[model samples]
Target: MATSRLLRTSAAFLAATALLISGCSSGSSSPDDEASPGLTTEAGAQRPAEEATLAPLPASTPAGLRSYYDQKLTWHACGNGFQCATMKAPLDYSRPEAGDIKLAVARRKATGPGSRLGSLLVNPGGPGGSAIDYLEQYAPQPASIRARYDMAAMDPRGVDHSQPIECLSNKQMDRYTETDQTPDSPAEVNKLTTAFRDFAKGCASRSGKLLSHVSTVEAARDMDMLRAVLGDKKLNFVAASYGTFLGATYAGLYPSRVGRMVLDGAMNPELDSRTTNIEQTAGFDTAFTAFAKDCIKRKNCPLGTKSTQDAGEQLSALFKKLDAHPAATGEDRKLTESLAGTGVIAALYDQRAWPLLRDYLAQAKAGNGRGLLAFSDSYYERSPNGSYSNQMYANPAVNCLDLPPAFTSPEQVRAALPSFRKASPVFGENFAWAALNCAYWPVKPTGTAHRIEAKGAAPILVVGTTRDPATPYIWAKALASQLSSATLLTYDGDGHTAYGRGSTCIDNTINAYLLDGTVPPKHKVCK
Candidate 1:
């Protein structure tokens, strides 16, 4: 799964979740911005140049793993009055005694008025997103699932609060976000490359040791460890966005261990970085078209109403203007075209933010950028105090290690511009350049694009939102088609994921499966 799922998926958590689905608003800044510090070149010097492919899992725990799987977990009160526990797993599963990573696990016991089923592990995407944070903040599963099953999650290795990955500091991030992804000239392209290079160097310096092991394959192995420690006879899960990829890996590795699983807003394991980036650009384009179609009906549509084509053209023009001369926001910071574009893209994740996007665009059109900046800030997980979460850092770290670069150089991206522009005239240039990010990654990728058949598994439910900007709906179709015994549930709507977003039909269908192990009929379509 590529980054379009976003750590704002973290930022998008109740954090951006509020901004995204609920249209939650936040205030912008006005203090003087500081210059970014020089990139550190000494952090991950000892990491192997060749990325470490995950050591193969043994058949039946390989005698060396008996202790990890048989260990008892002692749960205690943690965040939000829920139970939390710590477990240990080998850093390199192949070498059991070399070192161990501490895995953080949390759970809310079943609030049952009926018999409790096994635990249901939930991951709200972002290979970098904190699963624990999502569970405590907004818990996407229905209340009935909470009542019938112990709701739980684990922060995947190298993610927030679980030996988190650290890359650039806040000041550098400020510069990084403003660094133009869609460069129009050679100098601009060089600047963009430097930003990505520096960002990569920083992650390498700080997290070389952890970078190679943060691949989804290793994370899926961690999940199996969690499942065993939780005392579940079989794994029952609801994994969304990138989490779908993680869960699918688990099913493929341990098919008989799968119980009822829901893979919502899935990623096609078959797509390489270039294809993922191109498809994601198209996904955002589809979403923008949906937003534009609705915007034209509103009285204050800022992009104007001649047509979706005109709206895109106007939006593109505004981006160009911001690129040349940034707009001032409520904060002392100026909103460069890159930030403004990010703000626009952030809002595109959930159509609920479209009216706000229209209002913010109107503000930007009139020379104010606070609202748009706020959206960008939320997307980047930037704080009002000018601090940042490890999201931007960990996101790149995990993405780089998980897959090979989408484009190896600027020339490659340039060659692909036509296809991207054709995919999304408004957002294509940005996604195209965004694909260039992994090109300069410090660590090699441990994974590759392929299918996850999970052949002997029981029926798995896959949900797709027709107009989802991230994890395009077709991906859900592809994943469902790939998995044997998979059922595709279509949400003919706009947004990222579908289960808990006011869709009674989606919620009920998924709820039935989670609570009763009853998968919805194959290819079920819900509006």
Candidate 2:
């Protein structure tokens, strides 16, 4: 769910040369140039598309945002012993009284004698990650932290249980996940194009009226409403990957309301879609280099190559082989370039998965790709029943709304391929085309790339992992430099996020900040 444009810069290279570049803060409008409170077809009626952009409230106090956060929430028991609630927010903030949309909220109250620090709202990076599921399955904080805070989450607008977005059926989704991300020839390119078209059509047919309204800015507004309704004096949040962008947007829109915020694996909001793709391509290439460097030093490197470049060449050859003849998984599934790439990408997210990736690649080299195929299945969140979740569907719905597509034509992308390849030779081609997903999008973007200068915001902590694949390390530095009151925390590790992933130093540092309103020293590095 993270918006990645593959870049080839290594974490070490970025760290050594990281510069504090000023982010462009100009106010830009949507491309379609539609006026505010525009009307669009909804269900059976012509309803006004929610276009109210609320200015920050007059009061500078954190409590001011909460005073406006007034709403009645109806709670119910839902999913895995968590208490879920539905709260109504205006379809458009411009007209708070016009009509309301329901937000699905879930929470597990703090257990303890510790004084409460208020609600700790959390989002797990996916533009489509189920926050409620994250809270239930992954977020088990220290008793000291848990006992003092009400851990909570919401399925952001258009996500699961919150007017969910559905694009493809089980059959269609399987085909989609199998669609070749890396197209090597004219025929492959045509196949990729058709896949994109079919995927878009499925979204159009299923999501209907909801797709247009699922941008990041809108989701940020939804967060504000959730904060208000939850009776929080200020927004306390922990967001990773794409969620970092959401939190940053919140800080930009409502600077004074930010409280105890942590943006892990921060995204670079300053980059346009093209640059984003290029940088991410390079990021994957860099990660691949790291993997290759380590793999060659191991006893069982499948490629048996002495140098990283040779390992890369070997992998590329393997992809070409797969392009001609996809490997069978010994099950109903098969391994194509796209699925294989996804399997590699899944390992890139967490350093812990590197061993598994090595073994999977070894199996794949033997013409038995079941191991890699299984890894890809987990990354896609495919179940044994072949029923896939709506993560990918909702991912694009939200992303397309957040920013405009990088390029609208394959020709334009081809023109830029040289630069993209320069940035990340390993992943440039795939990411270049992936950016085209929004080209045929049913809805138009409502925002553009700009510097987030939350001039009056509280001290926001921006955490960056040294070798994060989804959100490259430079993004953390970029975001920190852009924000007026941001403190950058560096984690020299490989993963999408640093907190709660078994780093005592990272966890303790963040916990101290959240609990005591303490900001880490500028350019603080934690190993």
Candidate 3:
């Protein structure tokens, strides 16, 4: 049920107890802004063509895909020192000629005082999050790393600016997100399931042909194609959250082609959907415990300073109160139990947001839900004007396509509730119900839970944040153990990911690997 947004960038909003899944307006480089990769300046001025960086595809490349591999990209001078391009990927790899879909690509070339190493493709989690938005807005890479490698990103298929999947309308999404997750009545459960059904149907109706093709396997294939077009002999990547899964899949499929890859906030591909939800629930509980311990040390802590256990009871009580009598935000939207939970969950992604969560809880306790509602809005990526980016739509599309549902019926969910509650007393019920989302998916899963060894791949760095909420530290350990050449880098800290979040040790270790190919010893721990 947890949305594993890499480096814990922005928290993705999940509706109450259903496994669910950013918003950015769709963007493509304008025709007039297009330029050849090495021939145009960031200011759009003409320059002499430099030697192409594109590495030729292997001689064994299939004839059907040779044209795709041979395709040239014309970069555009996008704002803020980045170039953009559009690349075509087959809609269905099995039948290359069926059609092609356009993938939006963006890069900031290496600002060198050092010789350029190569392009380093980055993904900021969310099988649904937009890489372009991550590259442009988050830009977590340090200048030292940026100076040596072109930081590249592509919006994977069925994601933003890449034939994005569309689901509920803005208003529908609002209602859907606000729906009761901890259904106390059968009628409430039916309503919650109905919302999921409508969401799935909307995706099938609008996204249609693409829904069946947006699996992580296909996205990984797209990455390989991108690596070739960028002219890198091997794929150099830094992927977080769900991106870790994408990166591992690439290494598994094209082991010899992996280069200087880092998988942070790693996902255990071995776990089935049910186990992932349960473990993630426990992870969130761990994060909440950390938050409660910190809160108890502060004056006027909303949950009271009695004890962490007392704090959980108080928070649970608040949720129960909101469930019966919603709190009014300044805006038309009120803070219901689901949104209140989401708002709290959103802040847990990063320690930086703890103060905000404290303030929001204080406000909620005062019967003013404005702050919590705003946090929930941010989590949903709901614009003030009301339109949504395609992230929510694509999250389930990719998830359901990649793995089977956690629970196919309410009976199963009810049966599993006790175990979920044992995992997380506060958030377990919602997360358990959230896992039911894929059950209503239009397409049957194309993937199954399996370990990814990625044998023959270069040494891959696997990072784990001990208290990562969405992707637990245990998952990182599991992933590292599964990958043949992986070096486990443990951050005995809080937050969703380790690097680029003020940890000098984590940052230096990764920078050394990405810059000088210096792999750390096995099971290195950073505080």
Query: Which is the winner by lDDT between candidate 2 and candidate 3?
Result: 3
Provide the overall lDDT of each model, using Cα atoms, as 2-decimal numbers.
0.78, 0.72, 0.81
Worst 10 residues of 1 by lDDT: 36-45
Which residue pairs in model 3 clash with each other? 17-430, 17-433, 17-434, 18-433, 18-434, 18-435, 19-434, 19-435, 54-231, 55-231
- TM-score order of candidates, top first: 1, 3, 2
**Alpha-carbon shift of residue 388 in model 1 (angstroms):** 1.4
Best by lDDT: 3
Candidate with more favorable, higher TM-score: 2 or 3: 3
Model 2 Cα lDDT, one tens digit per residue, 259-329: 88999888877766666666667667767887888899988998675899888888877877876788889
**Positional deviation of residue 108's Cα in model 3 after best superposition, in angstroms:** 1.3
Model 3: per-residue lDDT, tens digit, 1-527? 12222223443432211222211121222212211223322222222232111122343678888899889999989999999999998999889999999999999999988999999998988778899888887757788888999999999999888889998788888888899989999999999899889888989898899998999888988998898999999899998899999999888888889999999999978766787777778888889999999999888899999999999999999999999999999788899999999889887887777777898899998899988887777766677797777777888889889888989999999988888888888988988898899899989999987778877789999998878888888778777887899998878777788767767777888999999999987757777
Worst 10 residues of 2 by lDDT: 34-43
What lDDT is reached at residue 267 by model 3?
A: 90
